[model samples]
Target: MAGVVTGDDVRITRKVQQLGSSTLAVTLPAEWAREHEVEKGDSVVVQRDESSGSLLVVPDRTLVEDAETTVDASGLDADALGRAVVAQYVLGRRLVHVVDDGPIAPAHRDAVLDAERGLMGVGIVEETTEAMTLRCSIAADDFELPTLLGRLDRTETTMRDDALAAFLDGDAERARAVEQRHAQVDKLFYLLLRVLFATYRNPDLNRAVGVDTGFPLIGYRSVAQDVVLMADAATDLAALTGEPIPATAREHLTGLEDAIDDAADAARNAVVDPSYADVTRAREALDRARNRTDAANESLERERPEPLLRLQRAVCALSGDTRHVRDTLDVATRLTFRDGSGATPE
Candidate 1:
């Protein structure tokens, strides 16, 4: 007799029965089977969850087509409707239909449109007075995790560079543009998260998307999140540049910004072509960024202008982001090393 795993909780015991000569079978729990509309001659999918070593039995119909969810927006407000759509998106739904009894409120309609901007692959495909259909156009075969992550790295690094330039040159136009690019970073981050969650829920999705690797999914997901945080830090740095600062503070800021840029470059190299040497270089860059931050703070006079104080805060935030990048580089380097040698360290 082997135990039956019911849903994500509870367990039941069942005995394996010999079927003819070669097949062995077990009965599904009566309650579970009934709830899922399983009957004799019906098809069910049995998938093995590698992370937990559990067998998952799901209805075949659930997997054969894209899942469509409908959100009733009859009473909920604009923000609530937006959050509902986001929640469904995060849960890996392929399509969401928002419906109301009458014409949808202007605020709610605007909110739904805004959500499409914030999320990747989500867009309004069809809309009427009373209903709207939002579709997630991300095809598993088209956007692989590695490809999306590479895009994330590029976008974040560019944002960081532009932010630094804006701050050093006191260019308000460039600073505003830096802020605009944060939206793209956010979209990419959301897309990466959606792919990660899809892979976790259905391991087959990973293979379908060509993510053929032994590396842990959590590691990739963490690195994607870190990249998003780095982009946000760069946005913060750019925002500070709209105000005027003393020339002395700008001199210190230059060193701090350059150190952060070096750290970004090292991290990018470590992820793309990881080696022990690149890992070491990334670590050294982080150390350099910390030292530069300290130097920048020390160089400020007692009568610091508001802009200089803001710059100091941005430097501290940038230092924290560099540390996060260094941590991700450490994981990537180890994975690359292991894959290359086929050996685990003692």
Candidate 2:
């Protein structure tokens, strides 16, 4: 039977004790059971280990008729998936698995692989299978977890706003400013990573969550890198010294920009409302934009030294921005589910 001991306050000691039967036993402190209103007749759950000859006892969970329990999403959407992985890292869940029902796309898989290198103690275990597992030994917590996500969001926003403004205003100074801002974002990203890894090393949080959360952490880092790269490319386009962007190129760039914005907006709905409809629509739009950009790039290559090469290179680079934007939406979508939205909770 488990019991508690009292000092200045009722307390419990969790440990292992040796038994003569080649086993280890832990006694519950008497004061604890009394304080908890536990009686001799009350049932308790005891977990036994044959390998180590150990036993773990607790108040019998089965005895409770209506216990409050939170449901874990065994299956996750993009947004929810990212947050879970991040939470796992913050909680020090090191061995994270992001398994899908079908085979993942090569691009998506590559993105995850890149994330593994960018994040601490993160790596891809099985990329070719129906479900992929990412492993990382990191700790995540409520306090700093949101902050890390927030910093990444801010980085994307800053880059997009700066680059877009520079392009519109035709200002070299603005382009330089946008580039300079990257340094700040980079610094914050590093700091967030440091905090995440530091939490992983802490015994308490690490023990609580385990390694499963690393996939999300790595995923988030990957998104941040994508955003940074996208923004940098956009800023470069804005700084390009070409004949005022051609009418066709300008129109195409504008369309791509609008599509990127739409994708981000669609993701917002998924994050806030979590309807599959919204995610589906966003995915479709993103796919179309990617295809259009590819076609535009090909056409430009064929018409080179004539009119579109300069614009094409600049615009193609901006495709990276769109992809990162999509990932950001995915991140946001993951967060909405965590806030207690069943299908898009609030």
The numbered model that scores best in TM-score is 1
Clashing pairs in 1: none
Stretches of candidate 2 exceeding 4 Å from the true structure: 1-143, 203-214, 241-243, 264-278, 298-307, 322-346
Query: What's model 1's lDDT at 232?
Result: 85
Number of clashing residue pairs, candidate 1 = 0
- Candidate 2 has a TM-score of 0.47
The worst-scoring run of ten residues by lDDT in candidate 2 lies at 62-71
Candidate 2 residue lDDT tens string, 262-303: 676566445434556677677777876787687667767775
Cα deviation of 116 in candidate 1 (Å)? 2.0
lDDT of 2: 0.56
Off by over 4 Å in 1: 1-66, 207-215, 243-247, 268-274, 301-307, 337-346
* Residue 84 local lDDT, model 2: 56
